[model samples]
Target: MKITKSIAITLGLAGILAFKQDKEVPVKAALQAAQVHLANMAAANTDVTQYPRSTKKDGSIATTSSRDWTSGFYPGSLWYIYDYTKDKQWETLARQWTAGLEQEQFNRATHDLGFMLFCSFGNGYRLTKDPKYKDIIIQGSKSLISRYNAKVGSIRSWDHHTDKWQFPVIIDNMMNLEMLFWATKATGDSVYYNIAKTHALTTLKNHFRKDNSSYHVVDYDTITGQPRLKQTHQGYADESAWARGQAWGLYGYTVAYRETKDKRFLAQAQKIADFFINHKSLPTDKIPYWDFNAPDIPNAPRDASAAAIAASGMLELSQYTGRSGEAYKKIATQILRSLASSAYLAKANTNNNFVLLHSTGHLPGNSEIDVPLNYADYYFIEGLIRFERLNKGLAIVSTGGFLTVN
Candidate 1:
């Protein structure tokens, strides 16, 4: 936690060497480029009801309604820019986008309020200490916990996959538990914390294989409270390791460890991190293919979003990994450096103004393959900020959330 001056200098030199872009600082330059892209996106996406999700095949900005799981990321990205620049203009833009999701606080149908509300209003309240945002987060947490089945021991992930699953839970649900932790912290309620802990424990018990790679979906028997099916909804096959799913598991367990300080969670996070970092299929650049088991191998599409998420997660996990922390941070630096390169980072005023490119969303469903995604940009900016803070001997993240640095 207290980075020594010598260690800080070493980290800074390591980051610079990782990029090797002459005198250009990778984090600063990427953030400057991100600001331009975000400003352009804000101008182009004028409708508050719709959020930027990804780009269409025709190279246009594809959008989603506030109910979509990804709706919070764009606003969250705005908040990150504000956090970095401390500019009121970015704050205003962030607030306007965040305000649109206020009504989602009561929507009980989906388990993504953490992604939809916490990422937006949660960041807003953290930065500004706004009581209104705090209230929205509390209400949203209640809505999210409403989906928690006592018998199943996890929040239901999707309502539409009923025919294929009885009580379905996805590994991505791990990301939602942070808001539950926030709820407990905000309201002094043990109920939210208990539910979050139970869900995380249940996931830890059933979601992971022996090797630490996770199944995307675990369909549980509602009556027996046991998994009936372990399969993939988006990956290559039932037994294959999905790239983004692995990232979610890695990131999610790291968060669990942070909130509860449970050594089990910590160990689980490290195992997942090791599985990902040491995977045989991972490219030299640290950007993973869409699926580690994808039949195409080197011909498979690279998922920049997965790389971004894992890098951000590993940066946080690195702080807690003791002697392995440096190794974790080294791989994370490689990922961030790759993402900031010309191959992944989009040109100014191009790629529909999205900051990064080559993200794969729902490959089995044949959707949003190899496109620029908002969440990729969100986490890329977050990783840059975390790395910069780490090198400067500062706190890598605020206690309020995992994305921002103090």
Candidate 2:
């Protein structure tokens, strides 16, 4: 009997991974467990062909399809695990998941293409040099820039009309700028880079408070291109600082500085980091509440995703800021340690196989109120990989991790 190409690939993936367990034993174990959990979840939900957005209370998953912003994270997680372990099976799974997301290349409705395309195919191209992935990313970047409003100097985050906001730009839009910068590098197109820079500068001017904590939404006047309202859509209050928004600001500007080598972005990133690290509301474990100013104080639900992203951003930020880099690295290390502990990291075959638990997605709106999210695990794995590289103290990071000046 002759096996088809698809059959052969399936057989190849059927073989268990031969994890080269080394100093990064905890992370290796986590990724291995994730593979098993993901495989089991897919088997249990035979109707679902791909990973969903997140798991709910009863062990059911959100059926949000590939068009959802979070659709990239599951594939991105597979890619990061592949990069960490060099396991062929991870690569195969990564390719499979990423392929399902290919249709999102032209999704122009949202400003999350960076989260959707770049995290999946961006990492895929980085590791494999797949020209196909490169093509998709360039096209996706173009689609992302289409949402940019030259008059507003920012990318419009939502298409829906609001009574108060004609053009709403959320802080989360900051995460999408990396794809534009990548497009500039991949295709030598300055248009993409310029739009990202303008968006970032405009966001910097309006989204942050004097102390650097960020608002969740900065609705701009479509005609004047100036910020109209400072409000919170997902936070505790309209005036309160949401934890994840601050995390996005920290990570976003870190990448901005890395791409442009602009000192202002670096300064902005550090200030956001300082706001987080010094805030009295941050937990002793470094995990932040769903809202920094949540009325409940210590009893507020913690967002592991925010901690994960902030720690990962701090790892890269550490390498940039000379002496202060060490302090940032220390805070990042503490956050990573807390996240890796039993309280957050899921046990083997638990939490519906989600990697990290207790990420509060949208508390005020009552969505994903303390469940595991795909993005949380994605950033945790990414943070661990960066931590391992940081420990190596070698220049391997400059290749796969962050940008550094000579």
Best by lDDT: 1
State the lDDT of candidate 2 residue by residue for 312-391, as single tens digits. 89988988899989889889888877877678877545677677889999887788988899899888888878887768
Query: Candidate 1's residue-wise lDDT over 302-376, tens digit each?
Result: 899999999999999989877788999999999998898899988766898899989999899989999999899
Give the least accurate 10-residue stretch of model 1, judged by summed lDDT: 1-10
Q: Candidate 1, overall lDDT?
A: 0.88
Candidate 1: regions farther than 4 A off: 1-25, 398-406
Worst 10 residues of 2 by lDDT: 15-24
Poorly placed runs, candidate 2 (over 4 Å):
1-49, 396-402
Give the Å error, residue 10, model 2: 20
Q: Residue 135, candidate 2: how far off, in angstroms?
A: 0.7
Query: lDDT of candidate 2 vs native?
Result: 0.81
Q: Give each model's clash number.
A: 0, 0
TM-score against truth, every candidate: 0.93, 0.90
